[model samples]
Target: NYLWINHGWMGKKVKYKEEKFKITAIDGGWSKWSPWSICGKDCTHTKTRTCDEPAPSYGGRHCSGKDTIVTNCTGGLCEN
Candidate 1:
């Protein structure tokens, strides 16, 4: 199967890989990495996680890289 990065905030949707994954979102400059949520509706300025690795136990395992992962700008954006 073919897969490509899907950007929901940009309304860019495409067919995804068959493998299971978890999607997350970050601001524009943070695209290459993950942003930490300092609080509800707020995020920390310190950049810790990168797109190349899983997030630090935010709760459970989340998709980090191209492992069938898609990036979205909202929590309810991607279907999985």
Candidate 2:
């Protein structure tokens, strides 16, 4: 029950009686990745890394594993 509207003197109507909020659940954030992209044909390469964070609202708790991760690069043997 909440209704508040007052504009100068042309509209005045206020009646509110609702106060009970207990929402808590948000645990998901990540932002630390962006330095592994430049290996797509050297000798068996494959690198990747990315993370922009921001993912968890109103009862959120996810994003704890991987945003983008790939490994396996040598670039030192390929020419036969």
Q: Give residue 29's error in model 2 in angstroms.
A: 7.5
Deviation of model 1 at 29, angstroms: 48
The sequence of per-residue lDDT tens digits that candidate 1 reaches over residues 1-80 is 76877787898877777776775453222135345333322221233434334343434444434422232333432233
lDDT of 1: 0.42
TM-score of each: 0.15, 0.32
TM-score of 1: 0.15
Q: How far is candidate 2 from the true structure (C-alpha RMSD, Å)?
A: 6.5
Number of the top-ranking candidate, with lDDT as the measure? 2
Error of 1 at 41 (Å): 69
Q: Each candidate's lDDT (Cα)?
A: 0.42, 0.62
Query: What shift in Å separates residue 18 of candidate 2 from its native position after superposition?
Result: 3.4
Error of 1 at 37 (Å): 54
